[model samples]
Target: MNGSDQTERPDGTAAILSTIGEVAYRWTREGDRLEWGGDALALFGIASAEAIATGHAFDTLLDDASPLARHDSLLIGADHGGGVPYQIEYALRPSGPRGPVLWIEDTGRWYADGGETARRAEGVMRVINERHAREQRLAFLSGYDDVTGLYNRSALLDILDQTICDAKERDVNAAFLLVAIDDFRLINDAYGYRAGDRVLAAVARRIRGRLRDGDIMGRFSGHKLGLVLMGCDENEMAFAAERFLAAVRDDVVATADGTVSITISVGGVAVPHDAGNREEAMERVQESLGVARDSGRGRFVGYSPSPERDAQRQTNITLSQQLIGALSEQRLRLAFQPVVDIHSRETVFHESLLRLAQPDGSIASAGQIVPLAERLGLSRLFDLAVLDRVLETLARHPDARLSLNVAPETAAGADWLAKFAKTVSQRPDIGSRLIVEITETSAIRNLDETAYFVSTVHDLGARLAIDDFGAGFTSFRNLRALRIDMVKIDGSFIATLPTSPDDQIFVRRLVELAQDLGIETVAEWVQDEETVALLSSWGVNRIQGHLSGAATLSPPWK
Candidate 1:
């Protein structure tokens, strides 16, 4: 048969299409005629071929609101004249009109031959419906909470800002209330997270029920709700907050495990009257909330903007901005402190330390600026910058080994480690000479990631050390699980080791523990020769403190 005959006669198409699990069908553009054949009818769960051939209109079969329906005209585009095939997938209502929806992948071509009527037809097959459902779920999750079906933090913030702006421009009044469940952690601790979730959902329902018309309410964050009340003055705001507080006073949430009773602390602020912008307004409201929670649990307080509070927040903002600028400009300096082998009295390595250079030529230690950088989400950036500097410094001193402190977040995550591994892979010479020290708290808090990090660094020919070992619990557990190379004793324990018998016993036992695990022990805060002698007697392998040398700005070995 010629191409035109093949297009017109799809009687044998069902057998051919069924081999590939598709359905065959034909349609005409002029008359909008549709014909169903092959396994396509069976895939769509339509048993009545007569009804499909007689009553089903092409337009009605397409979902009215779908993009497929909007693009129906494109199916018969320029490809028709060249006899080029085209394809589009869309949802099609089933034959019975009351059955389930079926996704159809339709392929069609227009046929024209001398002395024969031109016709357009397409074949369609079943497709997995997950694609459509996934798109819908993503759209829903963008604005609404998956757990409680309330607006999420981002959506709430947008609405709150718009409400505040409208209040400013139109000279209207509004109030924002931030309600937090008091001691929510207690519930989570007693029960599991699932039970805690049930309690939170119950609280959300109660708060939502208390909201009046023209008011917007949403889940702001963990165990917190933000409510925007239209036309609410100071007095009305107080009453509304009290009403919301009273709603959950006697209500007990019933979970599968047991019942949970909860109370809330609320902070309210009059928009535009309490503060000008969203950030300022949120700060004032949060401060009021803090006051309420601090005064007593389950209490409500209204915001009173204070110049002192605003000034303090402004100062923090300025400092954070300056820190960002300094980091970008690479205005950070490194100080090196020597770690000496106790038995040999040989400086084995220098620990790299961080210092921030101020605009006025003075330097600020990492302790003074790193916490602020972390709070402002610059920790990773700062961490990467430190790595870059360490690499450069190491390249300069090829014969010397350097130990660098890693931020908890950067040390415990795969992203930073991947970058570190790639850099070391490029310059294999520095791998054996670099020692990464993770603080005790960071390692124990995220043990799994820490284990991964340890394996990765070891594979890259670098050594891993636990800094401030005795400062937290799980030191022994971490040593047993992680293949550590060294353990640095916290300075506080070492400060009194030469004088205090209790400290001597503790350090002795710690040293024995490290020796048993095949890990070297380094004693910090070695202040005197007596302390050094005591550390050596206890079998500590290395010592790091002022007794050996202060943290010098430049590495002497380099």
Candidate 2:
């Protein structure tokens, strides 16, 4: 008898395979005999080892009907005196002629040395099982959050997409609720990160308890939960939002520091009503969330798309695409508006305004076009384009000075600052000739960042101005903290300064405040000589508007 005919392994092959729950068997290629070295026969419901060894039971044990099963020849290089080891896996046919099939991984090899064969099979099977378990773990982690045990953001998005498709096919409604915990950052700030985590887990549990089994919910991001409700309209969604809000509003979450009661702001949007697609639905819900948070804490708002809002959204979408093309295709044109000395009436400098010329021979003003760029995160592109032109013009005329408007988003970014600094540093003269303007609203939004920008501008030999002064809640404390060169007073007060006594008082006080701080003031929208004279009397240093001159393509200094 050859080595394949051996029924038992005297070598150490049996010990290794037995430890890891693997069974071993041997087959003779010539006689077509199969024999088990361990309890492998019982796995296939064979009556005994004799039943397999006596007949050609190899074919009967295999499920040839299964498309996935492999029954290829086990004899590879077996015709010669020696052959390399090969393994095959197949499905087991029903035992009682009515049972379900079971897949069996049969890793075996022809053995000149049966001990080496068993050792190799044991090693391969162990690796296969470990790899299978590792893959399952990875798959689970990818789809589910480890902390809350909920579907993660990416998985939830897929679910939302599928739900949207299902709703479209069935002509039903779907709504998504965005739940945000109010003052969540304060919790993390006061207590440690551990306490914040406790609050988050508690909130998730409370919200999850209230959701129906059919509905789906997940942690959308930090301090926010997304809930998907099927067959819900705006009214029904409002009720659902109330329920979700009730879950977190009244309960006090016990943390390490103490107990804290939290409130949630919820915003929902209905599909095929408020929006047409998933992206639009998400945008509408986000807007609703903003409205809810802005209203107050512990509030719920359902998105109602007004005709004007819808039209504006459409226009923004169209203009965003156009803005991208404008930046890439160099279609942006610059218009110069002078900010002259209020007393001298001489061109002090030109403020570069951007204009986008459409393919239809229509020009869009910076006011109408730049906001779309800011929203789409292309403000830096627009800013850099204007900067390049300003640099070129300044290079040609050594005496020229240009003030350019920097979008709040662009100024807040480090990348833009680095590039801007590098370009200005190369020519120290450019800094004195350049004036960087940031809006009052933008300055107040992130005062520290804006102050740093001011310092950097001063270092680069450029001047910084707080544009649209008095437009927002401008604290004098922060205003004085910034080392600025100019303050362009907001145009609203100047528009009615001549007629409105109340405006006259506000303008007078504003100019006095700026002078007291030793900051130069430029009064904007000086439409007539009367308004200009009033501003000049109030000690305004400069004036900008139609009175100075309308923004024109031609350079005023020329």
Among all candidates shown, the one with the greatest TM-score: 2
Q: Model-by-model lDDT, in order?
A: 0.79, 0.77
Candidate 1, residues 87-175, lDDT tens digits: the string is: 76667676535556766665666554222444554545546577768877999999998888889989988998999899999999998
Highest lDDT against the true fold, candidate: 1
Residues 165-189, candidate 2: write the lDDT tens digits.
8888899988988989999999989
Residue clash pairs of candidate 1:
23-40, 27-120, 27-121
The residue ranges of model 1 lying beyond 4 angstroms of the native Cα positions read 1-173, 180-201, 212-215, 219-224, 230-246, 255-265, 277-279, 282-302, 375-377
lDDT of 2 at 245: 89
The Cα error of candidate 1 at residue 17, in Å, is 24
